[model samples]
Target: MKKHNWSIVLLFLLFVSLSISCKKKQPVDADPPEGTESNLVSAEVTGSYNSNQLRLLALAAEYDAAVPFIKYDVSFIKINYKTTYKGNEIVASGMLVVPKNMPTAPSMISAQHGTTFLAAAAPSNVPQFAAFTGYELLSSAGFITAIPDFIGYGASKNVIHPYYDEYHSAIAVRDMLTAVTAYLKKEKTAFTERLFMIGYSEGGYVTIAAQKTIETSPIPGLSLKAVAAGAGGYDVTSIVSAIIDNGTYSDPAYVAFILNSYNITYGWNRPLTDFFREPYAGRIPVLLDGTNHASAISDQLIADPTALLNPVFYANMQNSNGELALKAAFATNSLLDFVPATATRLYHGTADETVFFQNSQLTFDKYKASGASKLELVPVPGGTHESTVLPMMLNALPWFQSLDK
Candidate 1:
C-alpha cells in the first residue's frame, strides 16, 4: 500500500492541483439539513472553495503551466448514514462534495480512498486537510463525489474496519451512494442520477467490490456508468499464496492488517501469535488500533514471511491442503469469479510490489476469457504501487469525462 501521507500528497496534487495555500480551507459550516430521509441520518456543509481558488492552487502545484481547469466552486459535506455491518444495521460516515451553481445536473462518483491506518485520515474526519484528499477536486470537475469512511472510521469507529472483505466494503459504498441520492433529492439539489466509481489500493478493491454489488444486486435509480481501479488486490487467495511462496513482501503492515481484520471480521479470534512472530505479534494489535501510520507498523515488523510468521502457520499457509479456513476466507473475498457487467478498467503499476501486479493480470485474463468485453487492463509501465495512482487518474478521468458527455 502507498504510504498514507504520500497518497494524500499525490492524490491531492492530482485532483486539487497544487498550491502553497493548500493549507486547510476553513469549512463554511451550515445548519444540518432538515427532514433527513431513508438511510441518511444527517448532512452538513463543512467547507467551500471557489474555482479561482482551485485554479490558483492548480497553478501552484502544476508541473507545467497546464493544469486541470477549475470550472465550479465545490462544497464538502460530512454525512452520517445508515448501513449494514456484520448483518447488523449501523451508522457510517463519509465526505460528500457537490458542485455549486451548475447550470445542468452533475453526475455522481463514489470515490473510495486507499488504505489509511490513522483514524484522522478518514474522509469525513479530514476537513482540516480536505484539499489534499482529491475527492473534492472531482466535485470541482462537476461530479457529486461521495467518499465513504467505510466502517471503523467516523461514526462507526468502534467497529473494526472490514479491510478487503468484499461484502462489507461494497455495502458501505453502495449504501452511501443510496443515502447521498436520497439526501440530495431531499435538499432539492439537482443531479444527473448517472454514477461512476474509482479508487486506488484498498480503495480500488472496494471500488470493484462495490461495482460487483451494484451490478449483481441492482440499486434503485442508480445505474453504474463505469469504474477505474488501480493496484487493488482483487485476487486475495492468489496474493496470499504468492506472499507465502515468495517468502518476502514489502509493507508488512498491510499483510498484518488483512490478517488481523479477517480474524476479527470473520469471528476467527485467532491469536496474533498464530500469524506473526513474538515481539511483532504483540506489536501488531497496538499498531493497527487506528493510531499508527503504515510505515511505523512496517518498521516494527520484518518483511520476511519466514521471520514474521510462525513456522507452522507459514508452512500451512503454503500447503494446498493446509489453512483451509483461511484459504476459504480468501477465496470468498476474492473477485476472480465475478466478471464485471459494466465498463471496467483495471490499472496496475507493472512494478507494484505491495499488491502484486499478477493479481490484476490474472483478474483481467479471467474476466476477458469469461466474456467481459467491456473490461480493460491498463499496465502502467515502470509504475510502482505508489507511482501508478496519478497516471491511472490522468488516464481514467478523461475516459470518464468522455462517457459523461
Candidate 2:
C-alpha cells in the first residue's frame, strides 16, 4: 500500500514538472503591435534631386546612367511613388530604368542593395562597387529597375533599420512594386507585364522574403514572374554561428547595425547602455561612412564582431536580444515556406568569403527536395561573393530576354 501511494505521488510530481516546463517554453507572441507608427506608415517614392543639388544628385544618378551602359544600351528615369501598408503612409524613393528603346518589355526586375553603410541613399554611386555590378546588366537587358531604400535607410523616417526582418524587407519590395505598377497604370506607361526580383547579400534575403509575401498576400494586380537570389545570408542562425566561431573578418559596422536595430525594435530585450561598450562603439559609426572609401579597407575597420563582447554580454545577446526575436519573426512570417513549387533562380560563388555558398546550396537543395519544380541553382566557378555579380548578370541577361519570347 505504501509503494502504491509513493508511485502516485511521484507521477503527480512528474506531471507538475512537465506542465511548468511547457509553459516556460511557450513562445512569446510574434505579432508586432498594430497601429504602431512602424506598422502603419505608407511608402512614398520621390526624386529629391534638383539642378541646385546637381553634385549630390549627379553622384546619386551616376550608377543608373553609367553602370548599365558599360557594355550595352540602357537608360533610366528617376521617379517617386507612394503607398500605404497597414495604416501608416510609407514613402519609397527609387529609380526606374529600362533598355533605351524597349518600351513594351514583358518583365520588370526589382534589384535590392546589399549592406552598404549608406544603404540605398547613394544608389547612384553603389553600382560602381563590384557589389552592385548586376544592376546595370539587368537594366541593360530591358528589365525595368525598381529599388527601394528599405525603411529607415534613405528618405524613409524611422529610428533603426530592421537588419534581418524579412517581413519589413519584403514589404518594402512589395510596396515599391505596387507603387510602380500604379504609376504605370495611371500614366499608361508601356512596360513589361511580368514582375521579377533580384538581390544579393542582404538584398538577396529581402528578395526571398518579398517573393514569399507577394505569393501569399492579397495585393491585387501584382504578379511575380520570377526571383533570383545571390549570396544571400538566408539563414541567420548559421550566420550568427559563423560570427561567433570565426571572429576574424567580420564587419564591425554590421554588428553595430544589428545591435542598434534590435534595440530599437525590442527595447525590452536589453538596455541601451549594454551596447556601445567603449571607444570602439562610439567611434564605429563615423568609420562606417568610409566603408566604401579605398582608405577604409586598409585601416582594418572590419574585425571580429564577437571579440568586442564578453561572455555575459554575448549570453544576453543570445537570450532576450532582438537577433533571436528577428529569427522568430521570420519563422512566424515565413512567406517563402509557402512559395509555389516554381523554380526560382539562385546564384552563389563557390568561393564566397562573405556569405557562405554552402548556405545557398542548402536552401536550393531544400527547395528541390520539397518538390519545388521552378528552381534553378547556378554555380559561379572561380568567383567570390563580391566578384560574381557582373557574371551573374551576364548569365541572367539571356534569361531576362527570354521572358519576352
Candidate 3:
C-alpha cells in the first residue's frame, strides 16, 4: 500500500512539472491584438449640418470634452475600411471640426499625432503633444481640422502599426480624408478647398509619407496645398546609424522597436536563433506593445545590442557575412525614397534627442533638389524635440495661412 501511494504522488508531481514547462514555452501574443469597433459610427446633426456632418461635429465635441483644451464645435466619425497587407478590416476614425458659422473656408488641416500615442488617442489625453498644439484652436480659427487614428490606434484594425512606412500611413490618411470630404460634400457644408497637413515626431514622418503618396497616387478629392512636418524620422537608416555611432542611451530600445516591427512585418527569412539570442529574443514581444512604460524600460535595459546580448546574437547582428541577407533587407530605405515635391514647412529643434536636426536639413536639401519650390525648413533655436510645438506652430500657422491665397 505504501509503495503504491508513493508511485501515485511521483506521477502527479511529474504531471505538474510538464504543465508548468509547457506554459513557459507558450509563445507570447506580440503581433497586433484584436479590438472592437466603436458603436458611434455616425452622428446626428440637430442644427445646420446634416446627419453625417453633425456626427463629425459631435465626435469633435467628444474629443474636445475628453481633453482639457479650448472647445470647438467638433464632430466625430468612424470609417470601416479594408487593407490588403493583413487582410484585417481596419477602422479609420477621426474628428472633423469646422469653424462656427464659417462658409467656404479656404483650407483644411489634417493633424497627425506623434510617436508615443495613436492619433485618435491624442486629443483625449493631455500628455500627448497633439492635444497641446491646440488643434481645437486651429478649428476655432476657421480651419477644418481632421485628425486620424493612423492604422492601429483607436478603431484602426490590425496590431502592428507599421513604424515609419509611409505607404500604410499614407493610405490611412487618404482614406480618412476621403470619408470626411464625402461627408462634407454630401451635406453641402462649404469649407476649405485647399488641404494642409501637419505632423510631429512619428506624425511628422507620417505627413512626409502622405505627401509623397498624394503626389504619386491618383487619389481624388485631395487638394494638398501645404504640408508641415516637425521632428520627423525622415531617414530610418541614418537615424539608426546616428544612434549607433553616438552611443545614445536610447539606441538599443529604438533598435529593438525597429527590429520588432520589421521582424513581425517581414518575419524571419532566416532562423530566429541567427539574429537574437536568449533573453533579448525572448523580450521581443514585450518591447513592441507600443506602451509608454515598456518603451521607457526598454530604453534603459537595452543600450547596445552587441554589448548587452550574448556573443552569438551580437556576432549574428554585427556579422557582415552571416547577416548579409538580413542587413540588406533592413538597409532598404523606408523614408525619403518617396517624398512629394509639395509645398512643405519643415520644423526641427536643434537639440532634438530622438531625431537629429540634421535629418531635417538633409530632407530639406533633398526636397529642394527634387524641384520642390514651396518648401521652408524652419529651425527652432534652443528647442528640443519635446518642446517644439508652440514655436513650430507659430512658424507654421502663418505659412499655412498664406497658402490660402
Candidate 4:
C-alpha cells in the first residue's frame, strides 16, 4: 500500500477546519503511526442472498424492471480494519460482498454509502439493508462491493461522525480498501486492477472527495476506472451557502452534523451555544452525540434552519473569504475548484429540494469550463434529493458496468 502525504492532508484539513469555524490553526498531524495500515481484526460470513433478494431490493429502491436478475448468490463478509480517525488509530468495520462463483477476476467497486444514524445499519452490520439498493444492486451485479462503516459507526461508533468532512471519511475508504485487498488475497480471489466508485447524498460527497484524495495522493496499484456520484453536495461551499440562504430547510440535522463534526475534527471544542440559539442550542449536542437517529434530530428542530442558528454565525455565512471559518471549510471541501481526470458522471434531480439542484448544475458547468470532457451531469426529471437517489443509482450501476466493458 502507498502511504498518503499526511502533512499535506493535515494542512488541508487544518485550513479547512478553522479556529472559530476561519483562522488557520497550527497544522497538527495526529495521524496514527505511518506503518499502521489496514489490518484485519475480524471476519465473519454474514449471509448469502439470492438473485430474488437482490431483485426485491432493486424494486424497493427503484421500480426498474430493467434491473437484471443475474441469479448470482453473494455472501457477505464483515471485516474490521485499522484506520486513523482524526489521528487516533481505531478498528473500523465495513462489509464486503463477493460474487459466490465469479469465474474471472472481479473488478473493485468502492460504493461510499449515504448518511445513516443507526449503528446497526452500518455496512458491516446489515449487509442486506445497510444502504439497501447501493449495496444489493451493485454487489449482486457481478462486482465485489466494499462499503466502509466510517468512523463513529460500526466498530467505532463511540466518537462523533465527521459529517460532510471529506478528509477523514476518504481516508476511511482508502484504509478499508487495504482490508478488502487483504481479504481477497487471503481467500485467493482474483480481481482486476480496475476500481470504480459510486456514492449518493453524503456518499456522493465522499466519493468525489476520495477521488480527489486519490488524485492528489495516488493509491498504489489502484486504478479508478470511473465514478458515479449522485445527489452529493459536491460543491460544499455552494451547498452550505444554500443552507444559509434558505429560510426553512427540510433537514436541520445535516446543519447540526456539520457543526458538531467540524468542532471535534478541528479541536475547536466550542459548545453548542456557539453555533445554535437557546433551548435548541442546548438540545442539539445531545441529539448529535452519536446516539439519536437523524430523523429524531430532525423532528426535534422544526423551526427554519436559520432560526435555529446563532445570529452571528448565520450572518458570517455570507462571507466567502476567510472571514468565517465555516465558510472556509466549505470552500475547502467544495469539489468544483478542481477537475476530475477520471471518467466521472454526476447525477441529480431537477427538483431536489433537500440538496438543491443548482449544486450539480454549477459543478457540471465548472467541470465543463475546466476542460474535463469526460465528466457529464445526468439530470433526473422531477426528482427531489430523496426521490432521485434510486433513479440516479439505477443509471450509475449500468454506467459503471459500461465503463468496465
Alpha-carbon TM-score of each model against the true structure:
0.89, 0.71, 0.72, 0.85
Error of model 1, residue 13, in angstroms = 16
Stretches of candidate 2 above 4 Å error? 1-75, 83-87, 103-106, 119-121, 124-137, 268-277, 285-302, 315-340
Worst 10 residues of 1 by lDDT: 58-67
The model with the greatest TM-score is 1
Q: List the residue pairs that clash in candidate 4.
A: 21-325, 21-326, 22-325, 30-87
Counting clashing residue pairs in each candidate, in order, gives: 1, 21, 14, 4
Model 2 scores a TM of 0.71
lDDT ranking of the models:
1, 4, 3, 2
**Stronger candidate by lDDT (1 vs 4):** 1
- The number of the candidate with the highest lDDT is 1
**Candidate scoring better on lDDT of 3 and 4:** 4
Model 4 stretches with alpha carbons more than 4 Å out: 1-38, 57-70, 127-133, 319-323
lDDT of 3 by residue, 120-226 (tens): 34442222222333453566555777776666665453466666665677877777676666656655667756888888888898888888878787345557788
How far residue 112's Cα lies from its native spot in candidate 4, in Å, is 1.0
- State model 2's lDDT: 0.57
User: After TM-score superposition, what is the CA distance of residue 188 in candidate 3 from its true location, in Å?
Assistant: 2.9
Q: For candidate 1, write residues 188-253 as lDDT tens digits.
A: 788885789999999999999999989988777677889999889999988888886785787889
